[model samples]
Target chain A: MKVIVIGGDGYCGWATALHLSNQGYDVGILDNLSRRYWDSKLGVDTLTPIAPIQKRIKRWQELTGKTIDLFVGDITDYSFLSQTLRQFEPEAIVHFGEQRSAPYSMIDREHAVFTQVNNVVGTLNILYAMKEDFPEAHLVKLGTMGEYGTPNIDIEEGYITIEHNGRKDTLPYPKQPGSFYHLSKVHDSHNIHFACKIWGLRATDLNQGVVYGVLTEETGMDEMLINRLDYDGVFGTALNRFCIQAAIGHPLTVYGKGGQTRGFLDIRDTVRCIDIAIKNPAEEGKFRVFNQFTELFSIKDLAEMVQKAGQAIGLKVEIDNLDNPRVELDEHYFNAKNTKLLDLGLQPHYLSDSLLDSLLNFAEKYKGRVDKEQILPTVSWHRK
Target chain B: MKVIVIGGDGYCGWATALHLSNQGYDVGILDNLSRRYWDSKLGVDTLTPIAPIQKRIKRWQELTGKTIDLFVGDITDYSFLSQTLRQFEPEAIVHFGEQRSAPYSMIDREHAVFTQVNNVVGTLNILYAMKEDFPEAHLVKLGTMGEYGTPNIDIEEGYITIEHNGRKDTLPYPKQPGSFYHLSKVHDSHNIHFACKIWGLRATDLNQGVVYGVLTEETGMDEMLINRLDYDGVFGTALNRFCIQAAIGHPLTVYGKGGQTRGFLDIRDTVRCIDIAIKNPAEEGKFRVFNQFTELFSIKDLAEMVQKAGQAIGLKVEIDNLDNPRVELDEHYFNAKNTKLLDLGLQPHYLSDSLLDSLLNFAEKYKGRVDKEQILPTVSWHRK
Candidate 1:
């Protein structure tokens, strides 16, 4: 089967691209490399040194003897996007090309506007391109688990069956995104669902949670094929930041009461979930949604886990509480259903102590690259 | 009270600006004049000949001695929007600045893109500008009833209280918008809701229904100040088009079974609702929603009403059923609660025979300007 990955240059996208190529699918990557540009603009580099796109592709081909096609262009450009879709003629398209940092989006009006335009408009182009050129192709879009904020009710996989006034109907889970970036994802979900309803398009929206870990099966093959590890306040996941802090003997910075609970998964599982979604295509006229995370952890829980891992490695680790930069519930109910991917035969790699030790050891190697200035929260959700 | 009316050259905006000015509010208009550009691009003019914007403003000032300040610029430009907000120091901002036609949005990919970009990004800019420059201003956004597509259950104002598994929770009403234009409104609602949540900004999203009628109390003052009456396929509402068709000795063209029910109000009620919203400001950190319509009618009901009105005026009006150009439910249950606006003291203008006759007589005076080709549905929601 042929598959095209729209944002195949970033962390998850690059890892997924290698995973799919190894599985013997004809893989083509289309990316604008905006993530790299964002890094330069913010003066923050990844903890792990990621090779350039051309070199990564070359190394992947060298290791596995698989040719992964590359097309570097913006998906917001319709001519470029449509031409790529027409030339590739893929049966499945994985879209991850978006401005994905909530902090970056919240930094200023310009960044917020860029995030909205790049994410929502870029996804809209894909929907139209599918409707006009590639109707048969299955669109597997990466939505965020953040779309369903901290609602009191259990977060169902993409939808909820609400019984109101003695009548039952299933609707897309109520979206209460906490940040502008997540709001953009909410917009994409609504737009994609509408396109399916009106045009009979097939789509699978994977509302994935925060992903941790840097080394995937494909990325571990060579030094040059390494995935990015963002330990900065802007792009780092909570667990990843804690692990990095733990490695350097710095305090695990816990925001607020350390009570913000969220679902999480390993980088390996993210690639595996993409494979599962591609193999199990949504039916025509359907916009399928899947909650794509393996386990849940509170900030306190992850902090303790990192402390334990650091002590096991004979390093002293402490936990520090900081004022929460974001305006969110310090303590809230968060139970999400994530059984869809498991039902599709995804063997999730939970955050084990051994995995934490491995990640800590990896972070130790990149300790010199860690910018201490980027480790703390700089952008407050509230205006000064 | 100082108020800024964005997009104050268009149908609802112009009327609301005049209404507020007559009520002694300091009203300023900021518009990019994109509506006029759209009219030129579509090669269609308003059935009622609209004077140039300068002339309309001049006439309003000459008659009422009210100076409505005008700023011609795009709201998407953050600098221009911020400058206007700073200069006006508006206590309230009415946002009607959006691409507001469903059929125009469905014409092609370009239109779909333009509609989403203009509407969603423009709204986002407002949210950011409020946070940065005008933190205390109340934002009154004009949403559409079409944001909630006909559902199996009854629709609430902006939220629904659902009882599931012996637990009840009130969530934002599930939005299932039909067209790209309505979807843009949904995006705006979500964004504004998020902004309120995180930034403590105040907003009122008026999910307005199809506004019929042309003359408001203010628009009736002078010929140059007449509001636009669009009878074209792209921008015209069903009731307005039916009345125009009857006036021009053409059949009232109802699409398909003409059983598509929608909530509606007069142009006068729209202005009244805006006034009510401004008077009743949403609480800080609250995204208040009000259903802004007074009556419900199907296409067939509207066509029959126009037919009777035409016959009363000694004109033979026939009803013709054309194949539906849009992909929608021909017959569906639509029970929407519009009590919020009523509770806000909106004395609605019902569609009486006198009212219908008045509209038809008004349309008849400009029947020669109505292009027969513009009356028919040209853009199909279905793929070619």
Candidate 2:
């Protein structure tokens, strides 16, 4: 099987690309390298030092004897995307190529507009390209768990059967996304669903939870092939940020009441989940969705867990409750169904099982690279 | 009250601006005049001869001695839009400025991308401007009923309360829009809702149905003030197209089985709905929605009505069922609740009462301006 990873230079994309290559599938990486550019623009670096894309791919080829093809371009450019797709002709396209930071989007109106236009137009171009050229290719899109936004009802897998006023129909689940970036993902889901209905295209939307840890099997094989670990307030997730804060002896900044709950998964499980999704594709003209997460935790729970793990490793960890920068319910009912991926033969990995070895130890190793200024939230949801 | 009517140079916008001006409100017309440019690009003309924006406003001032200020700029340009808003300082902003044609959006990838980016980004700019400068201003945005495609269950206003898994919540309605144009409106609705929640800005989303006829009381005052009537395939809707075909002795083309039902209202009622919404503003931080249509009709029913009205006026009329250029259900359940606007003091004019005077007579009076080549559908939902 042939697969193309769209944002192969970023964190999850890099890990997933290597996993696919190591599994002996033909794999190609298509990225514009904007993730690195954004880091430079924001004056922040990943906690772990990472090699350039070419050097990383070369090191992977040297160690594992696997060649991962590379196509560097923007997906918003339809001609470039269509040409790349034609050149690589993959059976599955894993799209992880959007501007995926909610804080980055809420920084200002310019960032908000750029995030939405870039993400929405990029996904739309791919849909049109698939409709025109490769109708048989399966689109494995990366949506976020944030799209559901803590609704009172249990979030089903992408849709729910609503019984309204003596009638029932299974419709796309209602979305109340918090930020412009998450709203862009919601927009992409709607556009992809429409394309499937009208043009007979197949798609699998993986509404993924917050990803933690820095090392996958392929990335950990050699030091030169290490994955990027973001610790900044803008691009970093809660658990990863907490792990880094504990390592550097900085207080874990818990926003608001620290009761905000969300689903989470490890990096190893993320790569494996992508692999499982590619192996079993959706039927032609079907738009399938899966809630891809293993466990659930609130912000305070994860901070306390990190504190305990750090104390055992001879480091004093402190937890600080700060004002919330986002406009969201600090305490709400959030029961989301994630049974579809598990039914497809995915063995999950838990955070407690790998906290010391995979997360805390790695953060301790890179304590010198931590930028303290980027530890606290800088972008407020409120308008200036 | 002071109000600014965005896209006030176009068909519905033109009539709406004049109506508000005649009602003793301080009105400002902000338009980029892209509607005229698009018609010239497509090599089509409106059935009614309309003057330039300046000439029309000038004529209105001469006839009624009411000064309507003009601001000629695009809403997508943030700096220009902000400057215009600062100069006008409007208490209400009536946003009808969008690429509002479904067929135009389905022409190709370029058209689809253009439609979504133009509409979504333009609305995003407005929300941000309101948040930064005019949080007290009410946004009367024009959304489409097509955002809710024909569903098995009845369509509510903009949201529905669902009972699922022993829990209940009122969430934004699940949208299944058919065209890129309609999907853009759905994106705008989500963005506006988020803005209202976070910034305490007020907005009213009018999920309007199809609008027919050409004359409002204000637009019919003078020849130069006549509102433009589109009869081309890209911009002309079903009922309006049938009226023009009946006047020109051409076959009234009904797509497919013509059983596709939809909500509709008169052009006269459109102006009144805007007036009513402006009079009763939504509360601050509230994202209010109203289904702004009075009645429902199928395609065949509209064509038959046009035929009867035309034959009674001594004109030859015929109906032809052609293959549908768009992909949609030929027959489906389309019961939608539209009592919100009527409850707010809207006296709707039925199509049966105004078919002869408003629509058919206008088509007959301007039959010489109709372009025969522009009568058939040129865009297909299926990709080439």
Candidate 3:
């Protein structure tokens, strides 16, 4: 089957591309390579000197004897994306192309505007392209767990059947994302769902949590195939940041009271979830949603897990509670339903000592590149 | 109190501006007059030849001795909007600054993109300007009833309390707007709600239905104060189109089965709802929402009402069920909760014979200008 991966560069995107390609699918990666420019702007690089997409693809081809085509373009540009989609005619499109950094979105107006525009416009273009050109294709869009926010009640997968005033209507659970970045994801969900209903387009929104333990089985083979581990404030995920901090013997920086709990998944499970979604596409006019997470841990718990793992590997690690920068409920209720992925045969990789050790070992190799300055929170959620 | 009405040159915007200014508030209107450009582009003008904003403001001043400050600027420009907000320090802001028509959005790719960027960016600028300058101000934004595309169950106001699998949570109702324009509103609601929560800004989102009446209490005083009554295929509201067709002795063009039921209200009630929202400010850190409408009617029912009212006024009006240009459910059930605004004291003007006669009389004056071609549907919602 033909498959196109939008944003095929970030942590989960690259891994997803390689995994699908390894599985003998005609996989293609579409990315603007803007993340590298953003990393440059912030004066921070990934933990390792990440290879270019060409190099990574070449390495994957050599390792797996498979070819994954590459389309370096912006999804927000409809003409470009439309032409690309028309030519490719993929049966499935995995959309991961979006600005996914909370700190960067809060940095300045330009970043905030860019985040909103890039994420929203890109999604719009994709929906329009599919509706106009390839109506039969399945769209597997990556939504974030943050879209659900920290509600006072247990969160269902993508939707919850609401009973109000003796009447009932299932709603996409009320979303209150933490940052503008997360809010953009919420917008993506809204737009995609609307488009699906209006045009009978199929969509699967995987509301995944912050993924760590970078690299799927395919990515783990070649060093170049390994996921791009961005440890900077702008492009890094929480678990990766924690591991890098622990590996460098720097204090694990936990924001505020560190009671902010969140669901998390390994990079492997993210790919598995995507692959499952591709295999089990939603019906036309249906927007299938899955809260793509496996485990839950507070900031304190994750930091301690990293600390313990680092100590086991003979690295001195301390815990530091920094001022909470983002305006969010530090302590709130968070129980999300994630049965859809499991029902689709996803055997989740739990965060155990071995998982922590694997990430620490991986982080140790890139300890010298950790930018301590970027580790500290720079943008406050409440501009007050 | 200094109040700013953004997009105060469009149909509802100008009516709202005149309504608020007449209420003795220091009101200012900020608009780029893009709607006129769009109207000109479509080779159609409003049913009534509306005066320019400057002249309208002048006439408003002449009649009531209440001058409305006019800023011919786009709210999409953050610098311009921020500066305006800082200078005005508005206590309340009524945001009608969006491309309000659905068919216009579905016309083609260009229209779709323009609508998305114009609406979303304009909303973002309003939010940022409020955050940067008038943080204490209340924002009354206009969302559409189309945002909640017909679902299987009864619709709640803005949120629904859900009980799923022995657990319960209140979530924003799942929005599945029919057109790109409506989808943009859903996205804006999410983004604006996030802003309100994060910045502790007060905002009220009025999810209103189609507005019909052309005469506002303020507009009735002078021709210059007349809100633009668009009868063109692209920009015309359903009722206005039917009125123009009736006045010109043409068939009332209905789409599909004409059973597309929706909630609707008068232009006066729309203005009143805005007034109520402005009077009752949302709490800081609260993104309050209210269903803003008075009554519901199916397309068939509305057509019959228009036809009957036309006969009562001595005009021969026939109902024509043209091929459904729009891709929506022609037959569906719609039961929406709109008690919030009624409780807030909105005395609605029902579609009585006298009221219909008033509309017929008003349309009679502009009967010569009605192009029969512009009264029918042109844009197909089905993507090519």
Query: In candidate 1, which residue ranges exceed 4 Å CA deviation?
Result: none
- Judging by lDDT, tell me the better candidate of 1 and 3: 1
DockQ of each: 0.71, 0.88, 0.56
DockQ of 2: 0.88
Query: TM-score of B chain for each model?
Result: 0.99, 0.99, 0.98
**lDDT string, candidate 1, A1-384, tens digits:** 999999999989999999999998999999999999999989998999989999999998888899998999999999999998899898999998998888988898778778988998899899999998888899999999999998887888888887767566788788889888998999999999988888899999999999999898899999999999999999987888999998888899999999999999999999999999999999998999999899999999999999999999998999999999988898988889998889989998988988999999999999999989999888888866
Pitting candidate 1 against candidate 2, the one with the higher lDDT is 2
Model 3 complex DockQ against the native: 0.56
Q: Compared with the true structure, what per-residue lDDT tens digits does model 2 show for residues A271-367?
A: 9999999999999889999999998899999999998888888889999999899999999998999999999999998877356545899998989
Q: Please write out the lDDT profile of model 3 over residues B111-130, one tens digit for every residue.
A: 87778788988888888888
The alpha-carbon lDDT assigned to residue B287 of candidate 1 equals: 97
Best by DockQ: 2
- Model 3 residue A7 lDDT score: 88
Docking class of 1: medium
Backbone clash count for every predicted candidate, in the order shown: 0, 0, 3
C-alpha lDDT of all candidate models, in order: 0.91, 0.93, 0.85
True contacts kept of 1: 0.62
Each model's TM-score, in the order given?
0.99, 0.99, 0.96
Q: Which pairs clash (backbone N, Cα, C closer than 3 Å) in model 1? A: none
| TM-score of decoy 2 | 0.99
